[model samples]
Target: MSLHEVHKSHRVGWLRAAVLGANDGIVSTASLIIGVAAAGAAKDNILLAGVAGLVAGAMSMAAGEYVSVSSQSDTERADLAIEKKSLEENIEFEIDELTQIYEERGLEPNLAKEVAKQLMAYDALGAHARDEIGISQTAGARPVQAALYSAGTFTIGAALPLVVAWAIPGDHLIKTVAASSLVFLALLGGLAARAGGASIAIGAIRVTFWGALAMALTAGVGRAFGVVA
Candidate 1:
């Protein structure tokens, strides 16, 4: 017998949070370091800025993920509540709703009704939640899980530039950080795309373009201010 295959959609929650957190960490931290270096800041100051960005970005990502996922969880709970109440008050109507849904999905009317009856018999709430409201256990929101994943990934990505800064000479700091960050962003994009079964080239290009733009803009601002200061 062939083994059952796991689908990528199952990882949607953590994958999205991790990718966003990591991309933000790399772009923002690298931008900060490049900006400071452009401004002729001391090497020690640049490292400090990168470290600070890592800490702040991780916390921000965590809070943002928590609030956003919590709101989604609230909506899901509200929907489930409504579904539950409808089932308790008028099961027949709810069954008809499910039947129609299956009918709309190409099942014949009689077959749809039969399937709906069986599903509702087995687990009415589970059927309604899955078919009617589009909530599945795999795709359900988990606020705490999302928050921790985002924060942890952000720290990992942000630390790359900091480590590079520590290992390199001050004279080559800005270029080194910018180049290395682009590579990191590209790799991250490719990996994320691969995980999602998307085109790696497209993902890499998209991330690299944005990373380069962020660093360029920050460096320009830093240089302009450096000259002024």
Candidate 2:
């Protein structure tokens, strides 16, 4: 089988978080460095800035992911609680709710009622969880996992520019950082597109174009300020 048949597309859920984290890490850190370097910062000072950005960005990603996913989890819990209470108090109405849901999905009246009855009889809560509450195996809330994936991917992506800066000597650190970051961004875009089963060329071009623009703007700002300072 081809790579596409290797597994179900459900894995794309987690992969999305990792890709987003890495993309943000690369773009933000690279732009910050380019801007600062163009502003005529010393190599040592640029290194310091890059290091600081990496740490700060990773932590911020982790905290943000955790908080956002936690909110989703809270809402999901509240939904489940209400579903349980409704199932216990109004079994008939709950079945009717399920039947209506199926009918809305294009089932005939009799078929909708039969399907709802069978599904509810088999597992009442699972039916509501999947249909009404939008909680399924593919997309569920896991705050800690999301936080860790985001933090880890961000750190890895941010390290690319840092490593390039460290490898290249002297004032050319700015050029090296920008070049390496653009290359990395292209790769990231292609990889994300591959996973999402889209046009890799389009994704690469779009990501690189945006990243280049960001760097250009930052560099322009830095140069404008550098001349003044």
TM-score to native of every candidate shown: 0.96, 0.92
**lDDT of each residue in 158-223, candidate 2, tens digit only:** 889888877887668778888889999999999888888788898888888988888889889889
State the weakest 10-residue window (summed lDDT) of model 1: 220-229
Encode model 1's per-residue lDDT on 1-229: one tens digit a residue.
7698767998888999999999999999999999988999988988999999999999999999999999999999999999999999999999899999999999999999999999999999999999999999999999999999999999999999889988899989989999999999999999999998889999999999999999999999999998436
TM-score of 1: 0.96
Worst 10 residues of 2 by lDDT: 1-10
Model 1, position 101, has a per-residue lDDT of 100
lDDT of 2 at 30: 86
lDDT of 1 at 113: 99
What are the Cα lDDT values of the candidates? 0.94, 0.87
Task: Please give the clash total of every predicted structure, in order.
Answer: 0, 0
